[model samples]
Target: MTMPHKTIPESNHAKPVNLRIREDVRVLIDRAAKIRGKTRSDFMIDAAYRAAEDTLLDQTLVKVDAESYQQFLDILDRPPSGAGFERLMNAPKPWQG
Candidate 1:
C-alpha cells in the first residue's frame, strides 16, 4: 500500500524583487562593490543614502541674495574691535550690579 501524500504549505507573500541591469552597469556596480569589499546591495544602499543626505543638505543650506550676502561678508570681514569690544566684554553683570 502507498503511504498517504502530504502537501507542502504555500506562501502567499511575494518573492523579493530582482533587477535586470545593462552589462556595463552591472560590471561597474560589481567593480565598485569589490573595491569597497561590500555586496552590490550594500554599496548601492550607501550611495543612495549619501545622495539623499547631500540633496537634503543642499536644500537646507541658507542662501541669501547677492546684496545681503555681500553685506554679511563685509560684516564678517570688518568685525568690531577696540573700546566697543572692551565695553561689551566688561559690561556689569546683572548679579554684580
Candidate 2:
C-alpha cells in the first residue's frame, strides 16, 4: 500500500527580516541546512517560525487535572448573570449621542 503524501501550503513571502549571528553560529547553521537539503534562509526561517509558534503556544496552552477540567466545564455550562443583559439594555447608543 502506498502512503499518502501531504502537501505543504504555499507561504506568503512579502516581508523580509534581517538578523546578525556570529561566524561560528553561521557555520553550524550552514552545515545543518546542507544536511537537510534546504537553503540557509529557508532553514533559518522555518526553525525560527517553529520556535516562535512553540513559545506562544506554550504560554497560551492550559493543563488541568480531571477534577479541575470538570469544574472548568461546569463553570462554562452555567448561565450568564442577568447583570450583563441589564447593562446592555441601559447603555446609551453611540449613534444617538
Candidate 3:
C-alpha cells in the first residue's frame, strides 16, 4: 500500500540555513534585532537580502557615449572642492586614535 504524499505550496516552503558566527557578533545582532522589534533571524535575513541586492546593483554598468565619458573623467580628475569636502577631510579620526 502507497501512502499519499502532501506537497507544500512553493511560497510556503522554506529551507534551513545554518551559520557559525562569533559570540560577540551574535550578541551585537541580538541587540540590534531587539531595538528593531524583530527576531534575530528576520533581522539577519533582511540585512543579507539588502546586501545581496546592493552587490548586484553595484555591478550594473551603463553604456555611455565617448563625449559623455570624457566629461565624467574630467569631473573625476577635478572633483569640486567645497565646505562639505573640507569638513569631511578635517573630521576626527577615531580609528587612528
Index of the highest-TM-score prediction: 3
lDDT of each: 0.79, 0.83, 0.85
RMSD to true structure for each model, in Å: 19.7, 17.0, 11.7
Better-scoring candidate (lDDT), 1 or 2: 2
Residue 70 CA error for candidate 1 (Å)? 5.4
Q: Rank the candidates by TM-score, best first.
A: 3, 2, 1
The lowest-lDDT stretch of 10 consecutive residues in candidate 3 is 4-13
Predicted structure 1: lDDT: 0.79
Q: Which scores better on TM-score, 2 or 3?
A: 3
| Candidate 2 lDDT score at position 12 | 88
- Candidate 3: which stretches are off by over 4 Å? 1-10, 78-97
Q: In candidate 1, what are the lDDT values of residues 35-56, reduced to their tens digit?
A: 9787887677667667887799
Q: Find the candidate with the highest lDDT and give its number.
A: 3
- Positional deviation of residue 13's Cα in model 2 after best superposition, in angstroms: 4.4
What order do candidates take by lDDT, descending?
A: 3, 2, 1
Per-residue lDDT tens digits for candidate 3, residues 18-72, read 9999999999999999997878988887788778878999999999999999999
3-44 per-residue lDDT for model 2 (tens digits): 863323456855788899999999999999999788898888
